[model samples]
Target: MISDGVSVEALTQWQEATVGSLLSQALNRWPDRAAIRWPTPTGLKTLTWKQVWDSAASGAAQLRADDPTPIAIFAPNSEGWYLSLWAVALSGRPLVPINPALTEREVRAILMDSGASIVLAARDYRGRNLLEAVARLNIVDIQHLWDVDDWISATQSATGAIGAVAPQSTFVIQYTSGTTGTPKGVMLAHRACVNAASTLIATLEPGDDETCCSPSALHHVGALIAHALALARIGATYVMMNEFSAQGFVEAAASSRATILAGVPTMYSRVLDDPSFADVKLPDVRVLMLGGASIPVTLVSRLESHFGARVAVMYGQSEAPVITATRLDDPAWMKAHTVGRALPHREIQILGVATRSPADVGQIGEICVRTPVRMVGYLNLPDATSKAIDDEGWLHTGDLGALDVEGRLYFHGRLREMIVRGGENIYAREVEEVIESHPRVAEVAVVGLPDSDWGEIVAAAVVPRTGATVSADELSAWVERHLARYKRPTSWRFVDELPMTASGKPKKFAIVEWFGAIDGN
Candidate 1:
């Protein structure tokens, strides 16, 4: 019914499917067509739909030979990573994705919690030897650890047939970005993922020949569902990046003749600032899709002018992907100011904190979503799961927003103290716990400071022990050992004492104002 010749009936059929079944359909429909394309030092590498399906089938066969426990992939985005992802799905094992930027301790915690028996990882990424780093964790539960190259090589001879998987079975155990100071594994069913991807594809309506360049990390749900699965559903070409760099993205987009590009606002800002961005001609690009963080109005205008593409803004979380998004035909003001209206078959309500009911139009409150794509629940945390999803089947997102009279949703901010730095969520308590562990620190409070480039940057306000002296460099080093690079505080302030309320809680608003004054904001 929309463009690109995808029928509403086809989307309805796909909503009740699994990833394996979809991949099988793609192989049959576009066997020789390009499925994935990525950059190499020499040039670009391309994989056809048949080649990807064969590789994944082989890998899935090998997985069937081992214990049927959850499998974790700890690597950057690459061809092998996609193959492994499909392999896990075909093998009927839940995939647990870990961010490659995480430290050894952080990786260990996920592996232990998920009880993943197998790990498919890159031998080295950036400067870290991931194999050695994971080995250093010394986790006894990890039974099989394969380097991606070796795993691909060993599975080449497999001839096992792919089996059908249940749509309601868990496909991915996606961990949140630690919005609550502790990372909770969100169990997404195959039906949820398939339906989410189908909805996104219907909304975007790209042609079968459309080529998309994506720089988002594969671990995040935004990229996994929106880019990876959605593109597959439509049988479009997907151009992936091992990691995101402004220059790298510009080069890939131009070289691939990309028709669609996707990334966070920070990535786009970096691209706009890059010198090569102006020189590169992305004339084929028709859509600039953005999500994962707030979109600055100026940045949206700049992106439109520079790329000559329609900018679409989306708002969602890992628990429920693609709750609301601006359509391709939306007016510029609507795209700039709101995240658009809820998609078809989805419902959104603004819960009034005071009235304990739906808020009036233009009244800001918590955003609640009821969708078929919502995650089944948090893994092994029934209490937390119940707290997030109410008895009415509505998932209460901790984000604050309001609905316009026209039914468009306007995003205000977060209800909790979660910092989104370059599209990565960092909880205030998570960072504060690390800083407070220092012997010379009495107490510490972490807050998000607004920035033009990064949506927000982590800032720490510390109180030193009596007669003790501590430097910012010392605290930074301490945090680096325990957390990821993005979670570390970039700005530090030492205060004699933190402002407190009568309830014996630190007044976070006062600290934010203090930082604003010091920065002359």
Candidate 2:
């Protein structure tokens, strides 16, 4: 029946079902409600639930006769993105959403690896033209290349049998954010999507008319599954932003009177840094759901003080959406320190070095989770799937963390991201937290560089605050005072900006590459 905090009405309203069925229910319940709203060239465009459904149905009818090979969607956040997603699911085929920021080479790799037979993409976004991007791809598996406009066209008269997708069938193959290495396609079932959305909606309990402003990309978990689908579950209005800017987000929320706002820590930092943010007043704002990367405590404090909105820090990987989130009613300390206890009917465990046994309370270990919402596995990689999800069905997350006596999870850095300096383990997040605390440092990333003597040396890449400057030596001294001598950065580089994945996580590999290039190594 879901968690105690969730009302009985919500529990019954949210059952495990195919995403196609859920969309149908939403259309029947809120036919005339404003379902999707985004800015266009001439002006803003708003689509009702019925319009969205009818458009998707037309696309589904056309695709129902084709083979179920996964379709690759390469476009920015737009109404066309959602329409293609819903249409593919209704046709009983998996849809793979690719980040528009990926290089042509990277996109080619994913296309070849997934063996996608169909591609739906926009002509252009910002300056990057998708038509040119597709021309650069050397792969031959793609049987059809439908423009985003034509794929979601409401005027198409194609009519055919729309197959019913089983709840256990895969709906989307969401690729992992390639911060450390090449991205892998994660297979997510329809039931998993439904359960994850319901769990999040039930936990937040947003009103039926709750208006949500989402600045994150539609391809990512935060926007696609958690924010968009969750809002639709409650028949809420969704205010979509194609591209995120501090000024745009502030104005959109203020204009729409959005009650909920969601984004990554970097996005929120940009908002706070923007001078125009001071002029915007969002009295209807109730909560700011922060996810993607480790959040700074200072950011949370500033949001609460300035906006008078509760900040909920959410933690999850692409494999398992919404594993843990600090509830809005939780105390300030809990919200700041830990990603709250497991959601309803979900189990989380911390395994020690042994990897088989649970760690003692307050002991740091690898975080493993078992939930119905867990992904099926990585696409076309059975060995990788076996390694990720064990025989016992527990998804072994590479993240290291500790669980308190009360079952709250305290996240460390990724197990692979640990910088081993002369046999001593230094978590990147631990050192990053120290450097980011500096007044002049707006953002920082800590990584390990290969060294002949130390085996691996710690390095830091710093992004200065706008109109602020600090020398590398100054930052070194700041860290030296706060952290141990070994934990301090042995090398530092100041950059205008850090390379980031679409989800806003710093690409540490890219930072290391840039540092190496600068050093002429």
Candidate 3:
């Protein structure tokens, strides 16, 4: 296995550290440095490493004095939101971070399923009042509820109660949307968080003065681990946004002099499409880490050209956080084509779909990983957990990919997302990448529609650029030139925009339903 700039000894040393301990170390090292920075409607705000640690200690002490049930935080990205997560971990309780964009029913399901007894949320955001929604649920498990303002204001002296937390204990239960349209709670241990943060800090080599600007929500794994925990581990600065806007991110990066920017592909797309994108200049930014979704080959080139920064594409899921990440010093071709090799202490193997055996080099198969940075299991779902994690402890990711001889992973598409047309297997991402290469295509999603003749035919739904008109025939002709005839999209639907999930992934099920309704199938 490749070392990837980190060593096994270093990973082992961090194996027994809890999230609370990690933050404490950072606070001790840089008590006066700014730990968190964000722009509010009132003005810009800042928090020192000592302030965050003390707030977390106070919150932890308060929760321990109360019922101490699983704590649920429903709020946007803010300094308070970030501290609450650390507070729960330090209190020896599992934290459940619900997406603020979830519907009332969805929020209720998570609170009830996770048995969360304490809730901390914003009074209202984006026209949704979480307090109102919680009042309607009437969940008995929730014994205490406080708004963000009240929670932050009630900070008391640090009681040093965080020392009670164990290293291997459960830290958070992150609920992610499943294929069946229900959210499954993935339990992550403190060691898992430590492992993930260690890998990210070692591979990325975050400098002491480096400031990172993150646009992802506090609930996302990328934000919780890569942006928050990793930043604390290295004593770097964090600049977060309450709401994501292309222009807002650009302005924040420029003003904060951010050296690193982390985001999903959709966020980058919006930034590139902004009207004032050409005028923005952020000279301090040296790295742009894009993940949590597909990164188009063309977008990588455009990002580097515009920002004068090296782009590093990372690949991982909620189950295993940041298993692989490309380096900043890697070649441009490697950064654009592959997601890089496995982390120093992690093991990745591509297993064949039908045979259930390891695939040879350059062969596409299901991407499986064995790593310390993994979820404990799905909460209260034994069968589902068993099916996802095998007997030997390998987490079988549903995504399909292949490994090069040098251990670099080349992602194909989701195993369920592959289309079988006339007994020929066709990957949707291969088609999507080709379609996204077209200059007029702003965004595209490829799905399989029910077809009696071919069993399932390749279909694509595309959103053209603003003020651009694109026909189905022209896109079909373009696809035929890059891919095989069978792999080309049999049907194309042009729309104003593509539906996305709360975590910024293309909603394939919604796209399929739309196609069925239009075709009368």
Q: Pick the candidate with the highest lDDT.
A: 3
Error of 3 at 139 (Å): 1.2
- Give the clash count for each candidate: 0, 0, 0
Model 2 residue 520 CA deviation in Å: 1.9
How does candidate 1 fare on TM-score?
0.80
lDDT of 2 by residue, 65-98 (tens): 7788888889998888878877887888888888
Assess each prediction's global lDDT (C-alpha) against the native. 0.82, 0.82, 0.83
Residue 514's lDDT in candidate 1: 88
Per-residue C-alpha lDDT of model 1 across residues 270-376, encoded as one tens digit per residue: 67655655676589999999887655555666787787788888888889988888988887768867898887668999998557699999987789999878989
Candidate 1 local lDDT, residue 520: 90
Error of 1 at 348 (Å): 0.7
| Model 2 residue 42 CA deviation in Å | 4.8
TM-score of each: 0.80, 0.95, 0.95
Q: For model 3, what is the error of residue 398's alpha carbon versus the real structure, in angstroms, after optimal superposition?
A: 0.9
* Candidate 1 segments exceeding 4 Å error: 1-5, 12-14, 418-521
